[model samples]
Target: MADTEVQFMDPLASHSVVPSGQQKQVRGEREPDRTESLQNTGQGEVEELLLSSSAVVAQAPPCGDRAACSCLGARWMERSLESMELQLQLLTSKADDLHNWVASGQDHFEREALAEAVSRFLYNCQPYFNHLEYLRSHKSQHTLLPLDSYTWLVDFSQQLCDRLEQLVLTYASYNLLCLDETKPNSVSPFCMGQSQLGPLRVAAFRYFKPMPYLAQVHTGLYKRMRWNVARLREEQREEGKNERVGDTEYYFLCYEDIPNADAGGDGNAVRTWSIGKWVQVTPGTDDIYDWIMCEVPQADYRRLLFLGSDEPSSSSATVRLQQMLSSHQTAE
Candidate 1:
């Protein structure tokens, strides 16, 4: 038998498309406007009627009894309800995406802009995590002590809970880089009282550059900490200081395991680290604030410790994540 060749439809057009299958629009479906022309017109516009040969609007068949009409009406209502439900579901999905976008700083702020600039990010989901708060922010050295620790503790907690929700920074899993003060920024550095501006007050300021490399985390189980020199601010409070020092001297927040750990490196999974001032340039203004160790805070460790201990305690292998950008907070 002679071989006959049949040309196949183009694959891009005929073979590949969504749903792995395609059906042409139902051929009998009447064009709305065109059908409007041929079907009926009760109004004023001058127009022509056009009708599709294959499509003729179907009318309800004549019914002899009232029961048939009622049944038909009910079926119509049910179909309309189903269609409305589908529309509502689509709208709901769009609304949810919008809400998440707003939380991610996408609605009012550009995504790249938000990522580039550092500011306080507030998360409403605070109650779920222990010692974490909604008011989380990236702080600078110009910030003071009390605010730094309080905010960092809370911010660290929020980030921990959001480990699963960090939509942007995806590579570093289960790793957090908290700001440790190689040299702590302190109030005492500017020892002189407010003098020049009405009294002997020194002006203070802080600066921070974007740190992308810090995101390269090595392990997934815990957070490791590193510190740089802490810079002092320019302002000198009215509060007098005992010593005279430069405005930007670096102070240190000394840390060891909390509850005083044994000399050996191996210890419990969740550990508490104590923070203390390495050096105190105390005058009217104290230079050093309380220390923050990589070890989990005392109260928070208790909280995480409570979780896996349902049966009056067995053991746990996970440690709480803690880290923050160095920010100088006001004494208050």
Candidate 2:
């Protein structure tokens, strides 16, 4: 204590006099880093949380009440059915108009108009037919609809099919329609003729094998023609035997190419064959002929064959035809 001047040191003074950089380092040490804290929380946990949220959202229904959702669905279906019914009614009216027009024996121009209208009707009806077919294939959906509604839809579709088929045949009977292979789907009169020639011939050929003929000088020349004529004659004779008037008739349109036969044999020659009678042949060019098979056969076997072959066998339309036939049978 001799001459010390009573000097006193504070311990906290040294701690408070730290450099700015050192102060920052000391504070950083005391506080945890945000990045490090997040790192400590595992990525798996974050992903699990996101997944759980998504699951909750997915599990939630469109409506809070189950019955409410069902009611909404039923209402939508009812509206769809109503709209479909309207379409059916409109188409039926058009079909009736077409029937009247055909019965009137209108001129060529009128026939052309009717043919275009028919093509359009068939094209338009395809969507509805497809929808009905969908309902038919899916039992659950079909059952969900009201019984009366489903029945009515099926019945209307069948009736529409019958009407359209008849109209096409009636139009073809005029022999005014010609085939233009280039435009199969065109609404023109030429393409409309396809509705009669294409499906019916394909169905008939597939169902009934070509009949055999005796060997002749021009065997290969008229092979198809001979077979077609023979089959048609046989079918017509069978129908006549039962004393039932046949609904279908076959007409051959040909152009002869003989070196010296009746001066080129009327390029647009058309001949209608009678029951059990063979078509007259000039023996010029047998393959240069087109057949117009008019009116659908009324027999069940023939009808089913025609329906099944209305489209390509592998097509959805064929399936629809089968379903329609099945439904028709059930109804009957």
Candidate 3:
């Protein structure tokens, strides 16, 4: 969706050419030269290969509708998704280890060591291009995270990208496009004036994983994109049950800017968005980051995105969101 274009190389362009001198010709009998015959055969083979590859590429539709995609494309997608699943398992294991360590009442030195281990894992687990591409295409599918556990990996990696600052713009642009695509009655703000942010931005903002608890989220529900609302609150309740034991359901607020109807103008304007709290909130800590509270209508979700300008802090966003929730409960 980003204006950036990717040029793909022809799969058969680098086919090996057999040397002309490698083929020998018989001395007599008026038979066709062996070398010529071999060359002709090779040329025909190359043409066939090229034609096959081109046909696959030409016929392949967007991955969103994988059921109708070419067999070759579907195979690649399956491979990519399988690889991602393996990688996700590794990440989840690492996060669980970290949580267990915290729960064990380790000393300060031990805690530091675990933190360092997490840093190493995060760096090593950075997704490959194929994995990222699959994620890009499979954004709307609920099949990826069937159980909705350990989705914080995406958020954690996204937060790391924000701190690194490299490739931020590229990610941002992609995220903007994805956000629009997922939104209901979505508007194309990037075309009107929004700048592109690349993959990191896209991952941090647009990517949605299912909540770890029961009950479906209403916003963007038609697209089958789940947020962490139900499970986040569930985690909050669980946190209260066991104070000392370290569990993974820590919560933090995150805010993103999205397109909204302009009050007095024809053009789209940015709106602040605070979904449910981000995962991995520190134990025994209250109100660590800034946030605000608000209710997002399912019908308007297409216009909503995860990245934008002039957003409020987590605390501010949390407060606003709380107010909205309370008011909505009262109205109901």
Best by TM-score: 2
Candidate 2 residue pairs in clash (backbone atoms < 3 Å): none
Q: In candidate 2, which residue ranges exceed 4 Å CA deviation?
A: 1-66, 134-139, 142-144, 177-332
Give candidates' CA RMSD values in order: 28.4, 34.4, 24.9
Of candidates 3 and 2, the better by lDDT: 2
Number of clashes in model 2? 0
Report, for all candidates in order, the number of backbone clashes. 33, 0, 36
lDDT of each: 0.23, 0.35, 0.32
The 10-residue segment with the lowest total lDDT in model 2:
1-10
Cα lDDT tens digits for candidate 1, 1-332: 00011112211122122121111232344556633321222111111010110011122224455667555544433333333233223323323433344354342223222221111011111111211111121112212223434443433433332332332232111111122212222111110001121222221111121121112232112111111222223443334332343432221121122332454656543343221111222222322332222221111111112222121100011112112112122221
For model 3, the local distance difference test gives 0.32
Tens digit of per-residue lDDT, candidate 3, span 176-289: 212333343222111100011111111112222222221234332222122112222344444432122222221223333344655565556564443443322222233323
TM-scores for candidates 1 onward, in order? 0.19, 0.36, 0.28
Per-residue error (Å), model 2, residue 319: 7.5
Q: lDDT, candidate 3, residue 53?
A: 35
lDDT per residue, candidate 2, 1-332, as tens digits? 00001111121122113222111111123224532322222223323332333333233224445567555545655555555556566667666766677678876555555555454444444444544433333323333445565555456565666565566666656653322212333221111111111112111111111112222233211111110211123554444322222233232111222343454755543322111212333332223341123111111101122221112222223333334434644776
- If both were scored by TM-score, which would come out higher, candidate 2 or candidate 3? 2
lDDT of 2: 0.35
